[model samples]
Target: MQSDLTNMQPPCGQIQRRTFLSDLGYGATGMALSMLLNREGSGQAASTSSGAATQGPHFTPRAKSVIWIFLSGGYSQMETFDPKPELNKYGGKTYADTVYPDPFQDPRYQERARSVVQVKREHDKIMPMQVGFRKQGESGIEITDWWPHLATCVDDISFVRSMYTTDNDHAAEFQIHHGRHKLDQKQPVIGSWLSYGLGSLNQNLPEYVFLGSYTDTRVKENFSPDYLGPKYMGVEFSLDPNNPLPFGARPQTVLEKEQANQYALINELNRISSVEYPHDEKLRARINSYELAFRMQRSVPEALNLDTETKETQRLYGIDENETSSYGKRLLAARRLAERGVRFTQVYLSGYGEWDSHQKLKENHTRSCKRVDKPVAGLLKDLKRRGMLDDTVVVFCTEFGRTPAVETRGSTKMPSGRDHHPHGFTIWFAGAGVKRGYVHGATDELGFHAVESPHYVTDIHATLYHLLGLDPTRLDIPGRKRLEIDRGKPILDILS
Candidate 1:
């Protein structure tokens, strides 16, 4: 009976029917493919009832792709970009000891801080900047010596030194991408929204791709589509070119020709199922996803093939150096994917909370900076030289910044490190629509608050959407009414 079913072909006028067992085995791939595709709407478009164009870019798009580089733990704003010479001057002094107004006394301190857990403020004494800073690039932006490579590219970057978020812990990692505190309901991340609102520039690859390590399961929320459905979730890729995708490669036992034949049969079956249940959105999505999954099996590996790149190009990403090789590969792959039309590529330069320098601020930050600085700078230079930077927005950000005050609880009684400071931080952007070599907004002299042109995490989302020609307000579904905060106003000051 199995042999008969496998060999049988339906007459031209009649429908082909297979036994349930035959369908079950061969249909598994298609079913899995549907889940992989995560196609929730029609081909290349969203099915929102907002009466807005679902295939987005509601206005003229300045960027074609986004390279969102996230450092999992907080990097100090004062030490990195904000450069608080005051911290060094006021070292060992309490907030009241400083001649300047006490930061903790500021009315906005309690207003901005929404701590998930009660934080013990034992670190009362202010800590000076652990690293030295030098003016860099034509912009003369005062960057710490740790990021000597990235400092060279400062003239092309726009620094927003006053970015802040409500979440005061590691949860801010999720908030940076989704624009909501972890206490609040999970909303669709920026990458997911972009996936929902826009069509694929490369049909073979996912609209949103995640590269690098995410061993911390909680970080998964950063790429989730949530209400947008599973298909819109960021598809993670392995740096290993031989095995780039998860469950994406064909089984060795199944010859290429045989698998192709099976997919064809599945397609026919899906086509028949579609006609029988024309309104089954899930079925339609599955059909689309299966097709894409098949294409991805071939295309994704090629996109990750760094060996094909010249020795110079490899060195350009710092791939030759042991210190920078791992992160270099990811950034280099991101550039490859972006140039090939991947809409959004989220690269984790380090693992979860790796930058959370609760202790050893100098040691931790120096090692962290070394791992990413060269690769990041290389990405910018390569993008510019290849003309990809003209339409690719590169965002360099951390979850938040370390506190200006010293942390005295763990082991060290002396002020050796800073605690988590959600009050204010710095994030930067380069390429695409943003003005080059400009600094917008700032922290107070003490680096304890976002004292100028402060922006919530969502403002970054709004800026990205605007640059990509998406109207965040218009990307709504029928039932999901987003809050005003969720649809944050774009930072117009930074836009070119």
Candidate 2:
């Protein structure tokens, strides 16, 4: 008898009952398409590093996975990790009131910002910090009162102040990973670099995974591998157990055993084609993707199902709470992915522009921090308890930071919020090879500039590469030359 999938009725097209893929995956039609796609600089060529390339990882690696937690809109450096008590000391004053040099007054500001001047440049008043901070743990790292849960994890984290980026717009979102101004050039994101350079541990899951809401879906450059090719890009998965892989489910009519047989048959056919096209890396990757997708049909669901986790474990992740539930689930899933050997998992919190507190920084940040604080702390604690901290790296960062000056977009001086400050901000790293309970670099008293050992965005990339035992410089392709800036120096001081 014909399988239910084969006999199933269709709504608009034959997709519901479609069976043949050999025509597209093989044959003369496919060969010509492959030739056009893989032409030099076309970014469709076979990977330089074979699947999970490690002909001896550059050095003995410290971390096996990275959980990159990115807050969608910029969070305030003054309000968050870099507590600028000076903002409270001299509130409602212009930059001129301070003895420091005007950051924007420098001739370099104009060129670096690409002419996107700070909103109300000179006249923008300094807004007082919205929250009070206290030292957390023995590290004496001062964190704002808004993040009690995260405060506990501070000793496990190393706060990296003096972090800056040039793109004044949300495009910094793209710049943070690409190592180039979003408007200027396109390059592979950090995840893609890792995915390309290192071999994955699990065959069932993607090496790079993206989980977050995007303000503009197109700016997902964080997961895109422009030159490394589409195969290196991140694969986004749904959190829902029933549809975690979304549209990757097995056919309704076919039983699991029958579906497995069908997959075997298709793989045999693809293998026959693989023999005909022995040099076609794209074809090999395609077949591997099919095999992976089948495996994911079982793996992803099992991984995402919360019912399997104990009630206490669920509560620890704040999965039982309403306000924290959504973000908690994402972090928990990220931890699960890392545990399963996914190399790089990028998790985004809140909706697009959710953290951009242009006005009322206190109200906006209080709620925003509450949503993620517990969940993040729980992930850290869980990982530590499981001994994963010794091998897993955790990162928390945003696009840039809110301005030290009050953001009076419409000339409302005391609107009580800050604008985007690309001059200086903060990010933190924990676990793996990174220094713990440490503070590296600093901004000025007003948190205006990265006064102490400032690092460009790419430095974070370099640090991650070092931890993963991949050298960005050595991973270059033959025809494509990477700029020196793209191979940022690793922040050695932050490493253990």
Candidate 3:
């Protein structure tokens, strides 16, 4: 019976179903190919690789890499590094009569202006900074009451208090990341520029890496390589302390031999396609991406592994504690990447209400400060101890700043929080050629605006590139002209 069944033939019209199915599959694949061809011909399928080999900065640089620490929400200059006594004297009064001119009162901020007053009415009278200020180190720069840990390292940092931005809202977030006004033409981020200019120091590792708690909110689709193409865009890593970069671990079932076989088959197909379309940059980029993906499969995992680090070293970064562990691990990872020649690393501080202080100004800022204080100070100390500080530049910045006026909305008796202030803020720089134990700029009597020698975000970018041995003005790509936004003058006054 089994033999008879095996030899049985189907009816005339049902002549081998397998053959029919294979023909249908081939027809569908051909149709898909035709559609792809049509799309390419219509320019709907764009290639993002044509701008890969642009010449970078023109001059010899001093620093090889940078580690950026971005404080997401506006950190209050008055509460943090910039101490002002006038805010205390005129605490509860409206600045409606002052020369400060309600800079944020434009029609764009009408809603925010209304909300600010409401918040102020409910919260406690313009609260004085809970923490005291002290002159630290030989420089005698006044640092806020909350940052004793950071104060100890003042000799290793340059504090710029007169930094200002054009945007008043969270949109400044985009401006700082992309180095252009939020309203202007979007440009490649500072990191992407560096990746394009320097290429990768470690082929196994990405040239640009972003790690932090607010990774999702911070990543912009426009946070891309833009005209420089996909090759220069940063490789974003998850903020997880254990595993950061996506797909950084080894595959369990896919053995080396199987991967190699698959790669060879893909390569053969790509080669044949390349012959048919020799001028296709997209095809070339795809081939390069496959090769990079394979290399990353090996290099990323090795770079992320923290088991080799000494237990004491881990503890020094506050990895042993819960509150500080996550950010601490990120900082340590950044340091490790810096040591391994990663050109750009950004570590974001996580958690809700991180420097926002909408309601509980004292409790909120204090708690947030404690969480990062040790890890940041430790990162600086560790870098200096290892002699990496001389070559690596560490930047600490916030989006904007909190207002000097008290916010009283939501409650009338609670400790008032500050609103967003874009006129003036503070940022600190350490390592590379930055002058240590120095303060470069200042705000006025009320600490409301940058009244003395104000600097913009572009100045920071220029200074950073200068430290990294690149002239910010000279980086250029072929064919595409450099825009005015790309030509930034370096702030030489603060350079060591």
Candidate 4:
């Protein structure tokens, strides 16, 4: 008894924008439009208003895109990329007992590490390396035995062993991306700033994309665009090709042509409304999203479709195996997104706090490394062979490195795991603009602090911005004056 148009009718009231769209036989289109409007409602318009950089690049760019791989939970620097034979040599001894100076007594200890709860940490017992390490690749960089596959590609990577942060807790996760402690005023993350500065190479796809799921809702702040606006925030996507864009599919009742016509009519209506309210920035932004959403319905799914990939390529990403499959798919998807001109893609290779090994450190790190090592190596190898390495930068990092001493919580000095150590850690970069097979900076003998050329987290951001040919100092909003710490100096020594 009802026609297709009848089902879309509102229940006789003053029609809101959603209800008005629904009344016009908009189905999936209405859902997409409403969501886009709501998402843009909370913030300012994007710096890239019409598919162009509001402020163009400052100079020639070294990288066209970036793929940031984040490993949640802290990983041990000594056990991973930075090998410290001193740990094994000084095992079971306090700093005073060893030949090296006592890190606890060093003035830099209080200057660099900031405890959130104002509680002083005292872990005097040294925890020896849980895993053995050996020189790898042509560079002979010492890496833990756990990352055998990544070891093969060591010559292509540049390891920065002296990265440090101020936050000593899990909140360092956000600090790593935003370059600010949890106690300070939040700013846009690295990806958000990139999106704000560069806009999109592919207008149909989001300029900044985030792959993989997060166990904690608060982690969204790691990809947020606080003052720069919602348009710069990273858009979350699933690896599923059939439904990569949730709530973005057309209804069965709506034909493809009908949807197109509906979008056209909506665009016309919004433009007409703009004439009535010239100051309505949200309305103008909504008009822009309609065209993007319509184009994304096809582009996003195609970009995520793994079925088009060959079995050999699938195996390269370790998708053929179960242990590495989850992270493998996400990394592979990140590559696909990058190839399609996505400016920045953030891939969460681990769940929130997955690497937090407070006890049984050996068991946790061994299994955790197995889950990511091969796939990460595969990504590097794949990028190199495809010639994408020359224009894409890959970053592998975690929130912080584990403490060197055995955790002494509740007087359990013999606990197998290390505590969170924000005083120093290790992170690595590869491909495009960075020096190859190079190791920059260093931690102390016991890996207690970044003793040589220590870099705060924002320096990493500054480096990325510089690689993209943007000056971090010049990329700022008018009213919001940034602190000097927010605009860090680029690490020029590591640049090619």
**Best of the candidates, TM-score:** 4
**Superposition TM-score, candidate 2 onto the true structure:** 0.89
Please list the residue runs of candidate 4 whose C-alpha ends up more than 4 Å from where it truly belongs after superposition.
Answer: 1-42, 45-53, 411-414
lDDT of 4 at 467: 95
True lDDT of residue 180, candidate 3: 64
Tell me the TM-score of each prediction against the true structure.
0.92, 0.89, 0.81, 0.93
Q: What is the RMSD of candidate 2?
A: 7.0
lDDT of 4 by residue, 187-272 (tens): 88999888877877887788888898876899898888888777667888888766788766777687889889888888778767
lDDT digits (tens) for residues 1-496 of candidate 3: 2364324587877854324433432232222222112112212113323223443445677788899887777888988899987666666666664545554443423422222122322222344665788898888888887887888899898889988776666667667767666566667778877776777788667778767654354454324666666566666666453545454333556566666566566567668666656776555554455555556666665676666778988888788989888888789889988888789997766542367777777888888888888889889999999999889999998878877777755555754577777778899899988898888889876666676777777778888878877765556554555565445557677898
Residue 35 error, candidate 2, Å:
22
Instruction: Please tell me which predicted candidate would have the highest lDDT against the true structure.
Output: 4
lDDT-best of 1 and 3:
1
Tens-place lDDT per residue, model 2, 1-496, is: 5464334566665542123454433331222222112211124424565333442368788898999998878999978899987777778887788776776776645544542434444435778888899999988889999999999988899889988888878888778878888656688899888877886788777788888665577656678878777777788777876667665676576577765665576678767766555665655565566566667778888877767888888898899999999898999999999999998999976777788888888999999999999999999999999999999999898989887888776867558777777878999999999888999999888887777988889999999989988777777777777788777888898899
Residue pairs in collision within model 1: 38-231
In candidate 1, residue 412 scores what lDDT? 69
| Segments in model 2 whose C-alpha atoms lie over 4 Å from true places | 1-56, 107-112, 115-123, 411-414
